[model samples]
Target chain A: MMDVKDRYIIDTIIEKCEGVRDPALIILQNVQEILGYVGKEYLEYVSEKSGYPLVELYGIITFYPQFKLNPPGKNTIKVCQGTACHVRGSDRILGTLEELLKISPGETTENRLFSLESVRCLGCCGLAPTIMINKKTYGRVKPSNLKNILAEYEEVDQYVVE
Target chain B: MMKPRVAFFDFASCEGCQLQVINLEESILDLIDAVDIVSFRETMKEHSDEYDIAFIEGSIVRPMDEERLKKIRSNAKFLIALGDCACTGGVNKLRNLLPVDEVVEKAYGDVYDNKYFEVEPAKAIDEVVDVDFYIRGCPIRKDQLLYYVNRFATTPPHKNLDMRFDVVPKEGEVDARSIIQYNPKKCILCRRCHVVCNEVLNVHTIGISQKGNRSIISTPFGVGLEGNKCIFCGQCLVSCPVGAFSEKSDVNKVSAMLKDPSNFVVFVVDPIAITSFIETLPGSDRDMGAEIGKIITALKEMNAKRVMDFTPYTYLSYAAQGEYIRDNRTMTFSSWCPSVQEYLEKFYPEYQRYTHPETSPANFLLKTIKSKYPEENLKIVLVSPCIAYKTSDAFDGVLTSRELSALFKSNEIDLDLYSCKKVDFDKDIEMERTYIRGVRSDYSYARLILEIAYMSKFHNLDVTLNVTPIEDYVYEFAFDSEEGFFSALLIEDMSKLRKYLSKGIEKYNLVEFYPCLHGCISGGGQVLTNSLETIDKRIAMLKEYKGVTDLKNDFISQVIKAYSQLKEVI
Candidate 1:
């Protein structure tokens, strides 16, 4: 298990509070930024910092897809499921990605480098079944080539690290 | 010389296509000079009892249209099916998938005398009468009308002409069960895939061979299209009206590209062989050379193509295998078409049949360009109308006409400004028009297929052909199966809905699915409405201004000479 950083968490909290008024919104954004998910640890951290009750922080974070507090993977793959994307066979892409990565939505790989997530109607429905990895977009992706897609990035990431 | 007497007739339609016809005001002047307009009810009150050419619009749904078409056919020397409704039964054909009586009842069961005039099944003009030529599109392109009128007027009568096409019907009817999996029931064989393949893509992979009731479009030797070389581009999905051909879409990839920036993006525009981009783009009768140049410029400006058209030598490796299969007297399959490859990879994996497939014009051009530049930074985006191209996974991104429309919509491609620019055909080099066109002619897979087919037949080799072009099969099978490979993006809740619906169920809502019905036209960011006539006029404009310029370039000529030499040697 990776140890959490306090300064990094404080920095994210400060970033959220810049213009936002709703305490729940700040905490939700804060939890997602800190732990990559809204988990128990994030709720505890929010209660201590903002003087908001743990129950209150948990209530907001769990409700929205934007908030996350768990120890998410180092690389998150968020796939869009919208009407345009759906007809274009975006479902199989998600399945193919899941099979290739060996992780379902909300789960991280053992290496902690990959986390799979699903998003709704990313406003680019024309492109349909769109996938995002670490915030980078890949359009018109098909299931037949899912392995190669993940492999390309992983290979590049490894090369960069080495 | 007496001009041909022509009349325009409308059926159950919005009369939009007719309006588009009238919108060709300048071209209409040219048309009026050429033809004797006997009865154009839309523009003139002058009635004609006789006509040589009857341009029919709309689908035959009402009892009146069926009789009206017969009278028009009887009076006219030739009947030209104009617009999609006149060709493929268009939007009204969607109702064909349902019970005609039920549909009519839903619209007007209680209001009027339902017993007096029952709604007939919607059908194209060809279904009702002998149609001489078909000008397809939702609204028929003015240029195509000009092309047909000019050509037909000059040519001698069909009886006097040396025609080889046998009009007689065939003996055996197609086992409807074999093709009709989802059983839409009203599967009028529009064979838009056949036209898209042969006319547009030039991939002689799908076509209607046998006549009448036996007429069916299939692969070369009529084998199941599991996996051949047909890259899924999804053009056929948009072209067909009654769901005769369609595939599960990959809209998710579109979402991904928008979200990601690190990925290099390049879209491949199918040269004239596959689709007339000029016609598909917004506006009518503009200089194609300039318009195409502008589009290429726009794309290049967007940093879409880091590489020019690059040929994949590996496809040659695959095509060589196909040639070898012929040489070795073994059954050979073409691997050049993406749909063919996908069919093999998905359904017919047993035919792990490797063919030394030649590079497509798209891959040839883009790969060469990408290799020359930043190969690492190269993310090839293929802007094609074909659905099979979507499945290739070769280019970094695959966009259909619908998808490109959405992309253009996103950037707000000012078509008015695009059209207004004085097209300089000379400076088209900026868009790499010559280079792309040169590569396309040198590497057209259909031309290659025709050459191969000719040689195969000439030699009388053991060739049993089952050639369903990628464009056709992708359309035919897309959105037909559960766990179908076409699934791209679906939320958990929607995914659950998809799971509950049967493949046969009209799960696709017309109101919602209407935009995507034509695929890219409905793409969220499309620049213009999907109008076939508009695109066609653009195509004519492109041809007039460009005028074999693509072939004239030294680079293209050299490539043509090289390919010609290769053709002679091979």
Candidate 2:
């Protein structure tokens, strides 16, 4: 599954991270950022290039929460489950997203348009409830406004499709 | 109503799990009555593409194995993984700790590029195809298989087996850190590994920690198996119902040595290892004495330079122990069981001096043969271990019987095709004249040694001895002489050994203690655990070829000289 381009990218990362003490974390962090998710094939390719064992890479991926084993949908939706957010109808917000996307938290839509997940906090708990679509965090997310927020990401999706 | 056409297929395994079906005996008739067995290669001749229920054994490795497994999956309505190999990739996955291409190239040499030989990291059958049911165990329990077959026949198809093993690894449970020795990925928290580690070896290196779903079999030694007093005997490996534990595979290493142009690989097979291998072999002719000869021929066909039968070689140790017994009344600890030596050295250091300090029979043969060969030639041994052989310069590489089976399979050296050849020797040592019996069991090996000592001390082989009855597998033997030169004790139980050590060992000239009743090799995971009947059968077969019950000085002199030369180096 590692194509020539992925090979080149992995090799470049290995070359850049070369000679660093315990470069596994540095290399893997870069890979997950670029590759969206660190899959088995990519981990093996990086392990081979970086001279780390596949098992070690698998350990690092599973140990840290940010490193995903499976590929995420093009857009990841993070709904805050912090105490402040939950007290202020974040359950309604998550339930609304589940209905609209037809997926529970921690599941990707069948079409791979969006992945749903629950986060502990978005730091702007003063906004009462928040959800993140990719990097853009929306403060004070309304259950009804979830459709319009999904439409915003769908625009970019449409642009790429054409 | 038509009978379900049941079938059996093997992938990367010894196919012993399928043979366990044959071990079912009278119940195998009941199994045949229920299903139309159309394609069991182990028990039948006819083959067919048709089958309703397919029992698949072994792991799906290699490109060809994958293709065949996919076909089997496509054809069958219900595909059940038959053993730990088929269910969880078994010992085949040990090779996955290394890269596949390198393993293939090293094992097969020039045939590396061929698609037929191209290997993938070993995977359980479920990894490749949708496995409907799973029956796990190195050789699955025959009664369990029968009960399942009956249940499936009478019930709805929704019963998909105990799918707990297939459950996803919870957050804290996924520890890939020590995946090489212990993978917590597929651990269903059965606590079999924990029990074996705690009770069996009494080495609490691994233990269950945490609570409920997240509980993991964590190592007590902080970092892993490294910090603990782990003997690396691989008892947990063999005892694990799931294929979680495996030693670093020396299969590819040995094959590479065999194929290397500069090195001459000597194959030394223990009778115990041979017995286990033959028992696992599907439809293997168990009754014949010539089967060992056929196995030798088969090893030779795999390009071994000189195939040495290890049974006859044990006479050197017997004679060495025998002569020593005559001179002294104290005991000599055997170095054959590596764990016993390791145990005494680590736990009971005071008794370490009593342990015999000689190269094992395999090393002795290697040393003597290497001396005869040009020193420039690199000679290595692909020897089987009765317990465990941690790699050392003494043995350049050690291979398991399962690995030996894999090599034999890949090379397509069918034992049925090879007519038994004259089993070889070094030509310098003729071992046909020496025969020591009762070596299969602990009691017998002791009796034989005491008999040898009496023959040496009294110069008579016909002296009848006295055996004082103790408990089961424990005994005290004394001759008519008050000097106690030939008086010996043979004890298999470990707890009694501790008790006897307090009582003093010097009362008897020899105290032969072997802890593992079936020998350590079976529990080492390299060799299959054979039924007592099968082990007895294997020993009986060797007895036909190797049974010369006497202590002849002519045979002893030749072997003793080579053995002493081995001692000179140490």
Candidate 3:
């Protein structure tokens, strides 16, 4: 975790969450960015300071699927299951990638190279069976291309991932 | 000369506004030089007799206040309703929907002798007594207060003493008439929105035409504001008076969201909206879109995670929607703008006959983010200019630009020197022009929808994300009038919109809506100062720095990569 200038910053942010003021959301987002996960330590710290119970904080953290308790993968895979891709054999492609990687949806590979998730129809539905790696998108991928796709990430790219 | 006797009184308020008034540092000197602040409990312990002007804050909630206000009105030569509570009753009136006693009890239930204070409906001073030229805004802007007081000082005694207190509808009183009566005679046509749009959004579409009484501020090229270059930013709506402009309401929805713990709340404010909060610096006229981005960044820096941008989605979807509306036989208003709905519902009530509740891209983005994130306790707020949307409650809080600016003052958040810094365009190494350039908002959503549609059709490509039940038209539908076909079928076209849609790429969980002619840069909350002053402030800010790096490009590249990689799995 990035060392905060003082505990007051985190304490102040956590303190404001009880009333559902939106500022808390920003603090959570920034903290998540710096720290891979919203850990129990932070939640407890927030609970102790903000007077909000840890359960409430935990409930909110779990409520948002985008939020996670574990470190994210080096590469997150968001399969486009939008209406268009569903009709274009996107399921088969997902199955192939998951099977090859030996991980279920939402689980990261043992190597921490990949994490799988799904999203609402990206506007580019014509590119059915689309997959987004980090921020770049690829359209019309055949199940056959799964091997080559995973191979690209075999070496670390210096480019920073947003 | 006898000190201009001044007495301050409160009715239905937290007494905070009164405190803020007394807190003015310089005003202490000027006020002491000009007048005597006698009956101020927050400031002075001593009481006073007769006064020239009685500065009254809060609303008339209690029956006793009515008697007290009448005495003040008779005793003083002038009575001025001080803050928004004194002017429009402020947030206190939101509780007017409930019984007056319930509101009182909710605040001080434990007090056994509460019977000493009998309260009625909280009303502006004008509701109870005559009020002279009043200053508006919750907590009130010191500048506006000074302006009014300064002007009062200079005007002749007859004019200065003349107080016109117009009685508006009481709080929570629902009127079926959606149209706000705009008497063109009342407007001076300062064209605050025009300067805001031109300088901020770079969409110089609204202009003044003709001459004298016939002359009016209008959309670019003299087009009907409804179906023209106007992007519906709501700047003009908030800026206009004599009931000239208003927005549809979603306040009920906001209340419901607040009640529900299952919804995570996010509030979206554009960067230009921040201009409402700060003193504009010199030489810093950044593009409305980029400026909004920077504000969102600052908000993020301030730990406002729920505060996000609607500009990106609005830009992406504008072309797609415009093309559909243009070619299709159906009559559709831009869903992004509540003011357009306000205009149609009021001026052309006949058109409201056909108005559809098609959600805008901002709405879409909000829903998507909520569903994707699924906060068991989430409520998304959209801080925007369309006050007509005050009743909508589509999100959680539809904080007006005025309310947003008030937040800065209320929280006493000072704008650091960093905030006043100008747009560093040259620093964006990757992009050609660093500062964002987009049309003003009236038709911003419309333009974006059209652009995306054309782009998608031309590229013959489509993106694949999970397809949720599209409650409204997504940004893929288009109508090709020349082709005699609605051309937005799923395709591989991505050429036309990829570049335009890719402007200011950032990951945001919330999408704000202003739909004003510009964002809140032209909001009612912004100081209506001289154009040269505003321009100078923007310019001065620009002189401070070289510019920012193309971190935006880097973020976009990552977002695209993520999307591309997702394709293989789906």
Candidate 4:
């Protein structure tokens, strides 16, 4: 149930992928980029557009970790586990986030404010023990800072609700 | 100690999966100890709706099936899909190949207005209700079923190692066209069917449609194999290690016909089929004479009116094939393999004139017997190494040597009791012709094509049919004489055939194609094997025992009459 503008963007992505090698995969990628994740409707749409059966499309979605079957939270929290970050205690930070958010890595919080994911590297090895919330990266982060970092997004959600 | 109350239910299935549980003979005691067997409709006279864990077989095909399944699911704490039908919509999905109207007519015979068969596209158990696990295979392997039952008392049940269809699987297999049933529930995803079909046969029919857990061996678009370029070559049936691929059985049909007093069921036993079946059996001497008598004795015990031997007719058949090939003025292939005939008809219809259905000895025998008896009740059943004979329904029933072995096992024929008693097939008529001058094997019959096609044309033509196989499966027959050059190609491999056909097949005036590797003796319906050693062994056994036994005299007279009538020039 997308509006006119989103429909045009998604439709154009599908049309571009038509007749390409591995069209289903390409369309799923392009749609996920625009819509944040390739959900059930997107999978069925891509299947219908590409003519690949549902099982194939569904299999691709489940197989690759990159392709999400559900919409992501408003703010994504990426805890870097790079070699330098691991040395500086990113695991402790990730553990605290998991406890506060009450969701494991790669899962959204119940309130949909933030989603947690542990990435290999954010390419900011100099900024060890870092956690990225949406576009902003909090460097030299401690485990205690996860509460304030997650709370920053929660306040914005509370304001919107008000 | 609370033993889990277990029940068994079946929907659109043979109920053989349920029976497989009981076949766990010694282990049945172990099963009863582990779980309380509450409901098994197939075995017990009574059934209880109340059960903790339900092992259900078969697929959902109608609203009633869906309703019945929901009721079972509600009653049971855990519902496990109990075979290919329940796990992957196995052979039940074969009906989904055709339109509901057409398949209904095929099965129920034109009672379209009936309420009982308000059919829906077949669905697996999970598609209707949540299935906790699956006991896979066509009939779940006895050891695996027992393991699942034992797990109830011992430890946690192993996650269904056989099935991985996390998503809805494609409608399993249509083998209606090619007699080779594919059940994904048993499939280990070996992709042997893909190689045999797409690469070897060049039919390009069966292949993997999806990937990973959702993968299924199917025709394109996951449609059934019914209206495809499948040449009914049961090559896949032999290639399949698991019983995932099997030929459609006609044993029950023949058994029923034999039991009917009004139906005169005449059994026609092929020599090679007997040879292969005997070789498969343990500690059997290579005495073709005694082995055939055993088969005849077994058939007679099964209430078969008359068991006729086809050994002598195999030689008679060679001459008929030779004449047919010689008579064809155009480039064509002469083969007794029905798969070859089907390939010619479906793919190369222009070569239809070259196809030899009239000369096919199996069909000829049935016709000969019918002409003599002129009785509507006579049912001619061919026990042969070929399942493709089922394609035409030419014989009232076509039983593979393996199926005949099953029939024998079921009837409990005393094979050891009837050894070397001088018992032969019915021979009442006398035939004067004996052109059966000990050929090497049936393959030598193809060599006769060049001799008969060339020599009879110009009697002065001194021709020796020299066969130089250009490739493993490609045979080039060339002989030069007073008449021009005589060139013929006998191709056994279907992959090589596509290249040859595309390169122009009109060059060879006497081309013969045997779709199977070594023709009917190594056919789809024989003792289950894909080994060339076994096939060559079977053929060697046939060659060693070629003219040891005699065919029926009445069958011989009819055969000779038909042969001469076909080629009046002879």
Please tell me which predicted candidate would have the highest lDDT against the true structure: 4
Give the runs in model 4 whose Cα sits over 4 Å from its true position. A1-162, B1-178, B284-286, B311-321, B324-328, B427-443, B454-462, B547-562, B565-570
Q: Write the per-residue lDDT of candidate 2 for residues B1-570, one digit (tens) a residue.
A: 677888999888998998899899999888988788899888889999998889999998877888888998899999999999988898999989888778887789885666577678999998999988888887788887887787666663574565433335666433434312666666677877666555655555577654566556666313566444555566666556666555666666777776776766666666556655665578855643466678777766667777665665566666667667767656676545666776677657899878775634545556565775644655555546443564344676666666567667766777768776546433434556433545434335556567666666665544556787677767777776554457777776554676788887767776766545445435364453324564466556556655555545445455555456545754
Candidate 2 segments exceeding 4 Å error = A1-162, B1-166, B169-180, B186-189, B214-218, B287-291, B359-363, B412-428, B433-443, B520-526, B530-570
Poorest 10 consecutive residues by lDDT, candidate 4 chain B: B433-442
**What TM-score number comes out for model 4?**
0.54
Which number leads on TM-score?
Answer: 4
The reply for model 1, stretches above 4 Å from the true place, is A1-162, B1-236, B242-264, B273-282, B305-332, B343-354, B357-370, B419-557, B560-570
For candidate 4, what is the DockQ? Answer: 0.04
Query: Residue B461 deviation, candidate 2, in Å?
Result: 3.5
Better of 2 and 3 by lDDT: 2
Better candidate by TM-score, 3 or 4:
4
DockQ of candidate model 1? 0.01
RMSD of 1: 26.6
Give all TM-scores, in the order shown.
0.32, 0.53, 0.32, 0.54
Q: By descending TM-score, how would the candidates be arranged?
A: 4, 2, 3, 1
- Taken over the whole model, the C-alpha lDDT of each candidate is 0.52, 0.69, 0.53, 0.72
Q: Residue B231 CA error for candidate 2 (Å)?
A: 2.8
Q: Tens digits of per-residue lDDT for model 3 on B163-215?
A: 33342332222222332222344456666655554444333445554445454
Model 4 C-alpha lDDT per residue in residues A1-162, reported as the tens digit of each score: 556776677779978876688777788888888888987666656655666655456656666778776678889999999999999988998898887777899898666777889999998989898989999999999876666666677764342321
